[model samples]
Structures are given as structure tokens and as C-alpha cells.
Target: MGEPSAPGTPRGDRLHHPQLTTLVDTARFHAAHSPQVTAVVCEDRALTYARLHRESNRVAHAIRATGAAPGARVAYLGKESEHYYEILFGCAKSETVLVPINWRLTAPEVSHILQDSGSDLLFLEDEFGPVLDRLPTAPPKTVVRLAEGTGPAAWTAGHPDTDPALSPTPDTPVAQLYTSGTTGLPKGVVLAHRSFFAVRDALAGAGLDWIDWRAGDIALVGIPGFHVGGLWWATQNFNAGVTVASMRAFAPREAIDLIRDKGVTTACVVPAMLRMMLGEPGVEPDDFTTLRKIVYGGSPISEALLEESLALFGSEFAQIYGLTETGNTAVCLPPADHIPGHPRMKAAGHPYPGIGSKVIDGEGKELPTGAVGEICLATPAHMVEYWALPGKTAETLVDGWIHTGDAGYVDDDGYVFIQDRIKDAILVAGENVYPAEIENALERHPGVAEAVIVGAPDERWGEKVHAFVVPVAGREPSPRDLHRFLVDRLAAFKLPAAYEFIAHVPRNPSGKILRRALRDRFWNDADRKVN
Candidate 1:
């Protein structure tokens, strides 16, 4: 495996304190430095650094009152709000692990996570009260309702607003985020305090500004906190002592309005959110004038969409690619490489300082440079393990390197290009066909808005390529037109054998394309899922 350029030595910065290694330390440090500054603002409620520190302290006491031991799991089921941050920090302060559940999950899904994690307490938003009634079994031992004048504010009222002074090492587990469960049941991924701050520490003086923070910069957390992207981004900003304006929920119009009203300087968003914001009615360049930089990822973005977003927002855009297992971002496509037609725009970018990435063949041997194989990552931010699943953990985290199931390769310059998930690769007559390549090509057509590629069982060839296309408004290109457009760009085996035009593609909350949902339809009755 080819090694990327070595990361620079660590250095200290005015904003970063060497003594502050944990989130609890960051909370205390920022409180002392920027006490009056607004730390987090959600909806109509806001919390200053001082107030946040105090309230979170009370929450720590209240959680301890419930008898939750250190390392105990505490789950939160709710939309983003100021209370969410309090609970997050409180869990950190009290030495408990915070597990943020996806509010969009069904009751059964929610039940499985809560039960599987063995959460001792649950903080539920009043909006989801009915979810408890629909659950398959009993809920946690302690359920705190978040409502007007009741939630954390009331529960923590009697407790002293002072730091618990609990000591947790840098490696202490603090957050437990679950996987998407695309293959099977979701497994809880445990992360320690070091996971959140390792990259920053490593890149302190690396002089690479792929993603940087500044004083007085107001950041928008458009992605929900339940996802590692949202939580990690928010924590990074808080560590920098800046104001963060989080949305109660991501709505295209509201996100635009928030940018205009709050003068949001930077934001972390997925490509879907960018597409939706650009498509919002009456959205103009002025609506995003305050935006100086946008960090986007979660899925590959089309060239057309990237150009449109750049022209409309007139902001520097950076693409980050990583999984929750890698503590959100292991690589970043810097702003300089974001040129509309640049080949590097398709690359997943070089790894951050101190991150190790390599491509390996099926036999567990490392592949040479420019060879396509499974991409693996070794970083300080790697997860501790999948909660309660030693076998699954062993299979994924081997010898300190995460076996990222993504199929990709590294160029001579160290840029990683992700093809598609290994399991998502279609076999056509013993040849490999990656859907991302075809999807990228299809999306380049003016008449096509989005395309999803899947493998369908075939009588002759073991598997055939099937595509679901979403046409641009007022334009529907025929299958022949699509084929003609892709003929010169893709190989014969990579081209879609059939096409079905649709209105929109189904995506999860974090904006990942649900390939399994569409692929399963073609193989429901097959003797085996694979061709």
C-alpha cells in the first residue's frame, strides 16, 4: 500500500489549549474565555458558554442522581435543540456515554437500539411521546420528557450548577452512535473523547486549511446531531469557541433564512441539502451572502450541481468523505481542487494529518498504487468497538485499521477515489461494474437530475445493470438518449441495460442513497440475492 505524505508535527494555537483534551475540558475552557458569548442557538432558545457550562453541570448531577454509572449509556430521542447540547456535555462531564438516536426511526427500530445499548435512562422529546406507546417492549428505567418548562431545565433545577470535577481520560468512551443497519441490525459504534479532537491536534500547524475555524464565525449545523457528522461538526466549533446556530430540523427555506438572518459564515452540509437549498423558490445569491465556506459530503456530488451551487452561493466549497466509524472525516477535497471540471473534484481528497489510508486486495494483502480494492483507514479517531458485538468488531477493526467496506484506490498524488461499496459492485459476466461511475456520468446529462444503478438477475449474464433515473423538471430524456450520452464515456458492461425514469430518489436522513431498498425489489423472490 502506498503511504500518503506524512503529517506535520503538532503545534499549539491561541484557540486550542494543550491541557484541554476532553470535551469537558473544552466546555470549561470556553466558558472561562468566552463566558458571555452565545455557544449554541437552536430555534428561539439560546445558551451562552457560561450558562451552558452551568446547566450542563446541573445535568451531570441529575444524571448521577439517577445512579447511571460511568460508561453507562444514556440515549436521547429528539430533534436538535439547546437541551440536546446540555445533555451531550452533561454525559461527558458525568463520565457517561451519550447515544443520540435518530428521531426518524420507527418504534421497533428505536426499541432495538435502546434495548441493545442497554440504556439506563432516556431523554425523549414530547413531540415523540406516542413512540413510547408503539414500542415493542418496555422503555428505559428512567425517561425524562423534554417539553415547555419541564425537560432538562426542571430536572436539573435542584442540582448545584458547578462542575462535577469528574476526571475522564482522553480514551474514555463518551459517545455511542449506531451504524445505519444497511446490512443487518445496527451496531453501536463507541467513540472516546480523543476521537473528537485528534485530527485538530494533529493538524494544528500542518498549514493545510482544508477545513478551518475562526473567532466570531457563526456556523450552521444543518445536519441533525444524531448523525456523527452533525455531532462532530458541532463539537469542533464549540472547541474553537464560536457561536453555533443549529436548526430544529433541516428545511430548505428555513436554512436559507437562517443564513441570511444570522450571517452564517460557515456550514457543514450534505450535497442533498445544498441541492434542495438551491432549488428552493426565490433563492438568490444574496440569500447566502454571509456564507464564506461550505464543507459538504455524505455522497458524491454531480459536476452540474457543484457548479450551480458555486455560482449561486459564491462560496469556497470543500468536500469531505468519511464514515461514522472514522469519526466523521478522514479525507477532504480542498477548496483549490473544487474547480468545476477538475479531475481531482471526483477524488475523495488526501487524508487529514495523522490519518493512515491504504487499499487492500480480497486476500488481505495491500494493493499497489492506483489499484482498485477495499480502502482501509487507521486513525486516532477510530472507534473503540461495536458495543456488545465482539465478532462484528473483530471483523471490522483488524489490527487498529478500520476495514472500510468502500472500494477505492490511491493515485500517485495520494488522492483517494471511491468507486462504490464493495457489496454494491455488480458482477456482469465475471466483470466488476461500479454504480458510482455510471451514476456520475448519467447525472452529467442535462435532462437527468439523478440516477441510481442496481444489479438485477439475468438469465444469460449472471447480473445486468438496471438504473432508476430522476429526470430534470420539464425534461424527460428517453432511455436511448441516456444510452447515447453515456456510450462514449463508459465501457459496454458498465452501461445500464434498462432504465426506469422516476420523480425522485429515496434517500436516508443523512442523504445517503438507499441502494438496498431499490436493489432488493429485483431479487425478492430469487433463490439467492447474488447473481
Candidate 2:
């Protein structure tokens, strides 16, 4: 129960984000300034800013009727919908933390997060009922299904549409998103209202067109709302009082059609989606005429993919590098350096305005330029802490910096080159083998559509380089030929000792390669997931 950020006072850096300070501010500000603007598009329904704000007020009162007050957690498990914003902004207005669930997760995974967050009320779509039934135990809270003219909407209609004016400061807990839990159990990353607005101020201060959010600009929300990427993307547009075209689920074809049909000016997508969109039928040079920018991240983009993407979309590309812990993009590779052959194109761009980053050695000391070390970032948008995990938070957020588990180096020109995940990096007879290097090289081959490299258990070499490749349609090259192609490009040891051709490489919802899943097939009997 903290007081609202002393009326108009700016927090974090000296830069002031005049748009909104808290999560609920989007509805409040936009409803007053641009009431008739179409704020969200999900399917056939579009919610105007005024109606969105008014509906959120009623929803806030409805949630309050459930006996949940400020600081209580309310979870939502469902797909992207126009009503999703009502639930989000309403909870914000009610001064409750919104815990958005990943619909792709299993029952156990979802259950763990609900239990961890201590949610007092669960709002889910009718389709998700089966998932709840699969769970061993129900969410220990009141459950309400969300749908039109029924459930949450029906119940909320009885309440009046008036702002509660609950006072929540910028430091107040707003949303708590659980991590993907690749290496371990998922932990809720607690976000304050500042986690988002801080980024807003930084982007405005930098004065970059790539993120120069403006009215009439349509943004395609392809990523799920559960990830910080999607939430931040939507927030940016909301902050600018612009329109967001939502794709309930990300299908490359549907996404392309939405961009063209909606005149989407910019979008945030991963490299995999870009590849799929380029390969989709009916793709033409003019198909993406309205798209001016494409911000991609989650995983590094291969040089081959980057070149193809530039030729296909014809949009200025910006690369973002950050994690859920840092809210979103702390460092941005601006569109200017997206040149196909530029050396800096391969590097993660410099830190955003008001954000500081440095390479730190194992001892937590700053590493000199060109020396590989952990990339530590101190951004205004850093998450408050790992929910209820102080020990883990202490290990990650040391001092004012978050030690990014990524192994990379800051070059003399202040460009950061991410090598690979330190935990995923393999040691072959004391020689480090970064899977990305091999995967990038494999992807460059004209016959290979995509590639993923991982370390396999080996007695003699400690761990051996293993590659899974998806060949181009109607093309098949022997492993020996692929080896010869790599022999000249990579060290002899870096070349894959084993190769398996597959239809596709499995990836997580965020577009990150599930290297653990790939490695698991070979080491089913092993005790640990990592080699």
C-alpha cells in the first residue's frame, strides 16, 4: 500500500516519461487524451481507449468484489483476446498483481506458478478447463471463466464503470511473469510499474525511430502476452496511444496477412518466425510494404538468416538483447548497423540510453574490452527481485547489476558479441566449443534450411559436437560433404562429429532452441540434462 508516485514526479533516471507511470495509467491517460482511438484489435473486436478504460473500471470493481485487495495476486490463463486488456488493466487499477500464465505449459508447470504466486482468483477461458482438470490439485483460489456476455464479462456488467483511483506507486508490484524454466524450475520475475515506464523514458530519450511510437502506427502482437517481449511491445504502443493488432496465436502466414491487412508499421518477432514468413507462399516484395521496422531477439540471429531477412522483408531491423529479469531490451542494436556484412552487425548493439553494461569476470571485476566475460547490465527496468527467492536474487542481482548468464564480450567499439550460454558451452578436451558457431556455419550452407548444435556425452573427448540439421526441401547432402564445407570455415575439432537430419529444430515458445530437449534424446539415462 504505497502512495502513488508523488503526483507527476519522475523516478529512476532524470528523464521523465510523461505518458504513464503505473500499469493502469495507459487506460487512464489514453481515455482522456484520445478516447475514440482504437487501442487493441483481437479478431473482429476492437476496443477503443475510452471503452477500454471504462470497462476496466467495472472489471476492477468486480475483482474487488472477490475479496482480493491491493497486493493480491490474480492469475489469467488463456489466449490473447481483446478482453485480455480488461483483465490486465483492471488488475492494475485494482492495485493487484496480474500473473499471466503461459498456455503452452503443462498442468504441473502452470500449477507450480499459481501456487508460487499465491493467486487469490483465477480467470481462465472455457477452453482451458481441460487443463485445469489435468492438474493434480486445483488452484487454491476462486476460479472464474472469461468469455463474452458470460462469466467475467457478465459478472462485471453489474458493476459501475468508474475509476477506483487506487494509489499504487511506480515501485508497486504490478505484474509477475514466470520464467520458461529451461535449466530449472520457473521463478516468478516480479515487475514494478517502473519496470515498463523506465524503458519508455529511455526509448524517448534516445530519440530512435525504430521505437518512436506514434499514433496511427499499428503494432502486430505476435508474441504471447506471458513473455516480457509481448507485454513490453503492447505497453509501448499503449504508452503512445497507438493501435495494436493482435494475433491470437503466431502463425507465420497469419502474422504476415495481419501486418499487410492492418498496415502494421512495426513488429517484434524472432528469427525463426522471420524465416517461416519468408518461406510462406504468396510472399512478394510489396507484401510487407507497410512494415517499416522489425525488432527481433530471444535468440541470436544467424548471419545467413539476417541476410535473407533483409532481402525478404525490406524493413529496417533492430536487434534486442536482454532477459525477463531486465524487463526487456536493455541493449539495442539499432537499425543503422543492420548492414548485411558490417562487423558490428554480428554484435549486440550498445546499451540503451540511461542503461549501463559492462563485461564482468568470474570474480565480479570488470573485464577489459575484447575479453570474454559475463555481460552485466544495470538498467532502470530491472525486475524488483525473484519472487520469494531472495538467495537466487542475491546471486543474480549483485549490487546494482544483473549478471547475465550469457558469455560475451564488449569490444573496443562498445559492441557486445554474445558467444553462447555459459552453462551450455561445451568443453572438448579443454577446448571450448560454442554451439552457435557451429550452428551458424551449418545454416550458411545453401542446402541446410536450419541447424542446431549441441554437446553429446563422450568418454574420450569429454563431450563431442553434435548437429541436428533440417535440410532444404528436395535437397540432401551427405554428412561428409557438410563436414568438408565446415572444414574450411571452422576448426577441425569444431566440426560436428555426429549429424542428424530432422524436419525441424524444436524451440520454446520464446523461439529459443530447446537444446536440452535435443540433448535429452541421446542421454536419456543421464542424471543431469547438461553434458
TM-score of each: 0.80, 0.78
**Candidate 2: Cα lDDT at 296:** 79
Pairs of residues at least 3 apart in sequence or in different chains that clash in candidate 2: none
Residue 54's lDDT within candidate 1 is 96
Residue 488 accuracy (lDDT) in model 2: 53
User: Which stretches of candidate 2 lie above 4 Å from their native place?
Assistant: 1-19, 148-151, 425-531
lDDT of 1 at 323: 72
Best by TM-score: 1
lDDT of 2: 0.77
Tens digit per residue, CA lDDT, model 1, 67-139 = 9999999999998877899999999999999999978766766888999999979999999888877888899
Superposition error at 504 for model 2 (Å): 28
